[model samples]
Target: MSKRDYYEVLGVDKGASERDIKKAYKRLAMKYHPDRTQGDKDLEEKFKEIQEAYEILTNDQKRAAYDQYGHAGVDPNRGGAGFSGGADFGDIFGDVFGDIFGGGRGGRQRARQGADLRYNLELTLEEAVRGKNVEIRVPTLVGCDECDGSGSKKGSTPTTCPTCHGNGQVQMRQGFFAVQQTCPTCSGRGKIIADPCRSCHGQGRKEKTKTLSVKVPAGVDTGDRIRLSGEGEAGENGAPAGDLYVQVHVREHPIFVRDGNNLYCEVPLSFTKAALGGEIEVPTLDGKVKLKIPQETQTGKMFRLRGKGVKSVRSGTVGDLMCKVVIETPVNLTSRQKELLEELDTSMGKGEEAAKYRPKEKGFFDGVKKFFDDLTS
Candidate 1:
């Protein structure tokens, strides 16, 4: 039987590009592949025909000759540059399925970068707001001094792997399917150290504690990260070291709770000072400042001290300090204090007149009386 035209076999036009040819070949090959066709001889022959057509059209020289002189220019029986032992099945497989399986054509491996490291740094609120220089000790891998991070002995060097010939990978074939995997002998490094370094033992790195000083910027809050470049574990085989991230966790303050840029605190006020009004000292980060309390000040009244809070690190804007006053009742009274209190209560009068002295208390009873009156009626 006469053979079909290569472009006709692959369902593409004569002027089709190599990319379009490959695409058509892949689609037809998958459809009529021997495995998919279940050992049908006619379909298997079609698969072989598709492979032969793809091989001839994809090769630049053979394709050029066939384009000018047809199949006579590429037929081996007719003294033409024919299929050289069929198509490179490995190349076709890689082009079609390499991305799905994460395997591709083998080459020398590049140096691997070191892993990043994180250090949780605890800071006081004062230090976080004001900023300070802190020294930390981190245990990690450092490049070997003896071998200069090469993993070889002091005077020697690494040699190319014998198994993969410095390709760092080996090809495994099962019938027509080909897969590339890391070379077992070299462990995918492409190079082998015959004389291992005494210090690092062929690993190219050594574990040691490193002391580094970090400058904490002012106004940095909790959850902030400070990056120190080239301070993480040393890279494999002298590659670039990774970065060290200093994670900030500010400790809770005894007097103040910070919220974003603002600081909140509860100030205890004596009932006498709250009722009569007075100038009281309030605690701030810098120092103590006097805040005047107005007459008849109630509990939970918030007083704002402008610019007494933290300055924002990103925006450079200052915040306020919110002081919520909590009225403290007089306790541990002596007989004389009790008599003075009794006299004061007696002077405030009783019933409707006493409502002026204790307005909230009278309002509560008034609401209770209306509730019962509605229920009865």
Candidate 2:
């Protein structure tokens, strides 16, 4: 029998990209997998077909040859036998399936690992910094109780397919082309089940919720992820289970904004308090602390509280907290208060240079005068 087109088996166009061909084959591999079908000899053939289609389409040289000669261009009888013999069928399955399952190269079909999963966990900044033990509910696929992963009815075993003689594939001829295809009767597994399990319906898995206790280390910020090995979805055909990743998102606190391990926050002070440089109360994750503002402190003056910020998980050292002081202008002033302020402003002098307390103010004005002098000159 002449070979059929590789593109036809994978259900992709001849001009399909390597990525497109892989996507089509992956869908078919997952849907018609022998692991999912449990002794449906027909499924075994289909699985092989999906595997074969992927094997040829993903390789650059093989794909190029197939595109040029269709199936016959690479067939053994037409002097292409070496190319066919050179391809390792098992390696191809391992290559694609390993990436999906996180396994290493060398595509061994059995003993596969489980899939990885993620859970979004929200926490207060305090709790995240202090570290906590949390219980999470996750949905996953577990082994089926009815079939015990055999996919056969109770008290029954699967039988090899009759049409393909347990090879799971059949030879087909079209005009001058001869190709091998998955046996339709057994789906490619080379086995058949006269009676399927009722609970899982021949699939060896069932959906159930699992409770896991995750230990969150201290000082985790938003967007940090925790990996839980062997905690993801169950693998098919009794392969290894997948891993679970817990993504952390910290809630905002009324007091602080975090940057790395540093904390930034605004502290409000009365006009008198800011002008006179007084001691004020400050908030910290651990507790309240007192900060002393130097006399003549202006608005937006930041005070650094050493060793008061969060302790990093990677580094043991604690970080500093920066408190930006905001001067609150006096509002609802009494008549006497307004009169006193006006008298004070008049006393400070009309030129107003004495009113400025910031460093380099005189230098800045002198520079500005010199700038125009240079411009005109």
Candidate 3:
């Protein structure tokens, strides 16, 4: 039987770019691979033919020779394999399944980093703003003291794996290709423990609870995290340990609510104080300070006290505390107080005089009158 054109086998045009050729070849290779075909002889032959075509076309010099002088210039049977290079099968299989089975050039297993751990630390608003040293208990894996992380007994040590002879990998010949894989007997460790440690039981690590002190900086808010290096789980076979993260959660304050760099609170004021005005004591993080309420101050008036809010964690800048005044009506009035209020209201003004003294109330009533007139008219 005659051989088919390489371009036709890969379903790509003669002028196709390297990327297009690779994409077409990968698609065909996956479809016709012998493992997927499950002992189908025709698919197996097709897979071999595709592999042969891919080998010649992917090499620059071989491709150039084949293009110039056709198959006569590059057929292995005719001219010593023409750049299919004997290693093509290994290279192709490595590219296809290296990540799937963790197989590659060396095939030696590597130690993995230990898993990270998270510790939630609850804090009061005051503590978060002032900072503190907190102690945390964490349960994690630690290297065994008896074996010193080697997994062998104190008096005896591990020996080189007899199966792979300390190479950690073995080669298996399949059809016309040789595939390199990790040794199953040693599990790719390259060394086998003859005597196991009593403490860690040949695992090289044991679970234990450790107490660590974490220094928290001031101005840290909820959701802030502090990282402690090498404080997590112990790695296998002496690998590096992971990190421990301290997550902060701030409790709500009864008096103040924090917003970014600002603090907000509602201040209640008596009606007499709101109207007559006076020096009042307001609470602050530091201490109480006197705030002078101006005469005739209305409800919902905002007062800003600079440098009284939280200092920013990142920027180191101060913020302001905003106070909203809410006027409280007098309650539980005595008979004499009620009579005095009525007499005072009557003495204040009437009609045009009332409008001059209570302009806002007069205007609201005028608006209501106009609304009703508009509907009736």
Candidate 4:
């Protein structure tokens, strides 16, 4: 039977690019692959036809010849075996399914990089605001000292794997499919250690504890991470080391709470000070500062102190401290104090006269009276 046109076999037009040809081939190849067809001779033949079309269209000279003179220009029976022997079948197969099998075209393996690590560091509010140099001990893998990370003895070196011939990967054929897998002999390292190192036991790294100093910058809050390069686990076969991340977690303060750059705290004000204006001491991050209280100040009143809160780490903008004053009523009154309080209460008369001293109390009761009168009416 006459062969079908290569473009028609792959379901692509003559103007299709090489990328489009390969994409079409992969789709049809997967559909009619011998393994998926399960011994169906027609589908297997269809798969071969797809492969042949893909090979012809992807080649520059053969594609040009086929486009100009049809199949006669590059026919296998004419003088050569056509484009079958030009490219490696395994390479084409690997290009399609290399990621599925976790291997690529067989070659010497490169040394693997080290693994990253994370260490959580706890800091007090004072320490976090002021910053400090902290010393941390980390247990991790370090390069072996005996063989200098070679995984071999002091006097000997590694040899190329005999099974894969130092390629690190071995080809596997399942029916019509070709796959690449890691070589069992060398475990994908491409080299075998005949005489293993005593320190690390044929491994390029050894476990040990290392002491590192990390500088915590000022104004670093919780969830902030400090990266220390080349401080994580040692790489295999002398590759570059990974990084260590120090995660900062600030401890809760006893007197103040931090929100972004601002600090909030509740200040206790005496009843006498709330009634009569006076200067009261309020606690801050730096030190105690005097805050002026106005006459007839109510509870839950907020006072802002400029430039007394935390400084932002990113923008360098200083914030204000918010102080909410809570009035503290006097307790455990003596007989003389009680009599004096009763005399002061008597001086302020009931009804309208009392409203002059406590206007908020009068307004609240007036609202309550109006609400009940409306409900009854």
lDDT of 1 at 21: 87
Instruction: Give the top-scoring candidate (lDDT).
Output: 1
Put down candidate 4 lDDT per residue, 1-377, tens digits, no spaces: 99899999999999997657878988998899999999999888988988888878876656876786677646655422133223233444454466356465547655667877779999998898888999999999999999999999999999989998998878888877666877889988889999999989989899999999999988988867798989988888988887788888999999999987889999999888999989999999899999999998999999999999888787988889999999998899999999998999999989999999989989999999999999999
Using lDDT as the yardstick, the better of models 1 and 4 is 1
Q: Put down candidate 3 lDDT per residue, 136-223, tens digits, no spaces.
A: 9999999899999889999999899999898777778777767777788888788899899999999999999999999999898876
**Residue 175 displacement in candidate 2 (angstroms):** 10
Candidate 4, after superposition: displacement of residue 86 in Å? 35
- Which residue pairs in candidate 4 collide? none
Residue 201 in candidate 4 has what lDDT?
96
Off by over 4 Å in 4: 1-96, 99-106
Clashing pairs in 1: none
lDDT of 3 at 136: 91
Candidate 1, residue 300: Cα displacement in angstroms equals 1.1
Error of 3 at 111 (Å): 0.5
List residue ranges in candidate 3 displaced over 4 A: 1-96, 99-105, 177-182, 350-352, 372-377
| Model 2: how far residue 184 lies from native, Å | 4.5
Better of 1 and 2 by lDDT: 1
TM-score of each: 0.72, 0.64, 0.70, 0.72
RMSD of 2: 15.4
